[model samples]
Target: MIRIRLGARGLGGVRFAVSPMGSAKDLLRLVGFNPGTLTPSWRSRATDALTRHRLGLLAVVGGGGPLGYAPDFLRPEPPAFLTDIDTALHQIATTPQERIRYELAEAVNGHSWDPGSGHPAPRQLLQALGRGEDHFARRLADEMARFWHAALKPSWPAIRTRLEADVTARASDITQYGLAEALNRLAPNLEWRDGELLVHLRTDSIHRLTLDAEAVILTPSVFVDRALFCAGEPPGTPAPRTPLIVYPAAKVDCLPPAQDPLIGATRRKLLAELSQPRSTTEIAKRLYLSPATVSYHLQILHRAGLVTRARRSRHVLYQRLGGMV
Candidate 1:
């Protein structure tokens, strides 16, 4: 369990921003490491591009499994609401050598080195980073740029739209309902209780963070299927910066037209109705459509890898995949 205690000042300082590099890293994770809930067609295209570009360094740096540890320096908190890829890459390329050393050491300490773990020669990479090598960081940045263009750039507009919608919805929730309600709606694993935001992680270890004055930046990502917490300052940072919470955005109405031509207006409406699990009859009643029509569209969407269905007692429930968009 990871509990973040946000005082009044910390709560007031909470804001939302979008990070391109963060999404890029998540893209890498979806392609090179964990597929999570990504659609088959999209994942296939991204895989082909990754193979064509031969992003060796990126594969090593970003190849950690879904729950594996990666260096935090790879995705720095964006300074603005919408940070372009160039600016985010620059921030990574110019990371101080001391911070790089510290982060690399932290990674090394957390996991044992495995030569065949899809991470090619991580020890050598760490050694290069430890020597205050400028070229190492530059090469990393260059790889990230190439990877972004190859895998994520094509779908960036749709991705950005989804992230923006999530931010807007959450912001409105904060205004209309309250911060606590907004926080609880972020993910199923997160909860707001007693002035603390509790993140129920897969790990058994417990960590408590007090946000003294540092704010929490809520950044939504299309590739992140779950909530992720990023905090703490690397060694040589000027001061403690805002923490980041990268959660999955709602997965409706963000698909590029080229990606799925089958998603017509009716299917789109059906998808929106599936923000939560529902039965065919329930969806039909809500959308004012016949159960047969809803079932037909749901079957098409299920075949396209956009939704999943499972039996729940006497009824079957369908829900949209988290990373479909």
Candidate 2:
């Protein structure tokens, strides 16, 4: 369950400090108990704050990003928060004791896609061990590696990627508690105040943090804009890119080599014919490529949720899904 100390009388009566860079709605949701009652501006303001953020440490909400590999997604049925954790641990302990394991996982399909009916709770899942008859030690280390870095998983592809993906997914209207959701989802052990989950370097509360925060995010549904505990002064006046932005670019860059030349050309031909509904063969011929190549890229795009297909006249028609803007 969400944790936050509340006051009597009203949400305003609740006395606490808030982090600076979180969704105002997350705070409002915690204090006001109204996720849907928030105004559209609340969502818009939250998005603006994220985009304006210099350090890019904010979390993603409302569906955005590569969708590369969300380990959390495993099945369609989700369990209760506590139940999910319990089951996850149980699976790790009892599932034939494989060396490698998936620490964070989620269900694959949703029973329905109702508003507020998107993601199931954390429980309601089956855990299966990895298959490998040999190399127990190697696999064990790999499994532990994921667990050790589990906290970072939710913030993957850099915080920017997560934020971007979230924005893209929910471009129209939204009720997202960005900052709180990010902290809680990324690292749930911390307490909540003003709707932002405390994710300080120090495990202690904001008061105990020896150093200042690198960043703070406010959520939607707010104007008085509480939650302003910055780590320290920003050297001078603030700009878009706050604090500093130095990195071991060459040391940690993990992007794969640019797309293969042949694959790249094939991709272009597929896109050109996606205007109206057409089968892979139709597009392939227009681009002078084989149906097999078109089908492969189509698979990738579909998995990316970019292209949609339907069976029309007993033949599948692929249409370019146009949500990414």
Candidate 3:
């Protein structure tokens, strides 16, 4: 449990931010298959994506545990709303060597109060960084780049749209429901009580913090189903003015492809089947649609620019177009 005592100014100090680095880190966690803290539905969806990509560094970066901690350098303060991947990567590359070592130590060393198991992969990687092995650091950075392009960039437009919608919803909540209500609705385990905000963390340990003047930055995330609380400063120290709280967005579905209600059921089924390349007979067999009906729907899908066809040894396979979703 985490308790944050808020001063008089806390109510008006709340702010909303969209964090690109945070989202990337969250997706890295999903790639590592560490969805123990996520909702069942999200876990299933994330697991499917991870299996499809099979990123090698995901398991390594996950640190061989459910609590895989990506080095903090990867998550800088949220940059501009449209911060590019290269800019974020450059910031990470130039992180002060000392800061990298310090954050890595904190992540690897078990918290003084809680003796929960720690992650080894990060520990080893930290050692490499400690030795000033810039090569290893560069390698990890490359993996981050690859992971973002393959796993995230493809669905980023949809994710960004959902994030914007969430921000709009939060703004409405603050106006209509008031600040306290908005804070409470941030997560199931959060509550805004008299002069304080309470966060019931999944862990058994309880921690207390205070936010004197800095407003809390509330970042809505598509991947973080559970609330993630980060103290601006180390634990047990004087509380910083601004702390960050990242929680799952209200809409659980990250990327529901643009669907046309006017399109017939068979076309919808064909579009769904064509998410991956499939032959007409294969789609028909799986969807229980006749081959002729499948063919008609495929032709319609092709005409609408929703799908494309390519010849594959004695068969013409169809797949959803790149930009349609």
* Cα lDDT, model 1, residue 147: 82
TM-score, per-candidate, Cα-based: 0.73, 0.24, 0.64
Cα lDDT tens digits for candidate 2, 50-145: 444421211221121122112211110112211223343333233232212221221123211112454442221221122331332233223322
Models ranked on lDDT:
1, 3, 2
Per-residue lDDT of model 1, residues 1-325, tens digit only? 6667788988987888988889887776666556655677568767776678876666766765333656666787789899888888998888777666666554555432344456444655666565564777888898888888887786676566557756876777788788899899888888889988777776653444444434778888877767877755433454345677788886665644533466888998888888678999999999999999999999988866667676989999987754354
Please give the lDDT score for candidate 3: 0.62
Model 3, poorest ten-residue lDDT window?
Answer: 252-261
CA RMSD, predictions in order: 8.2, 19.6, 7.2
The prediction achieving the highest lDDT against the true structure is 1
Task: Give lDDT per model, in order.
Answer: 0.72, 0.32, 0.62
- Model 2: lowest-lDDT 10 consecutive positions: 243-252
| Candidate that would win on TM-score | 1
Residue 145 displacement (Å), model 2: 33
Q: 183, model 3: CA deviation in Å?
A: 1.2
- Model 3: per-residue lDDT, tens digit, 1-325? 5666777676666777776666777766664546465544345555554466664544355322344445555665554555667877776666666555565565556431113544343444545555583555565666667666655675566566557657777777778888889888889988889877777776654445444434577787777667877645544443122566788776422223333343455666666666568999999899987899889888876665456677989999987643222
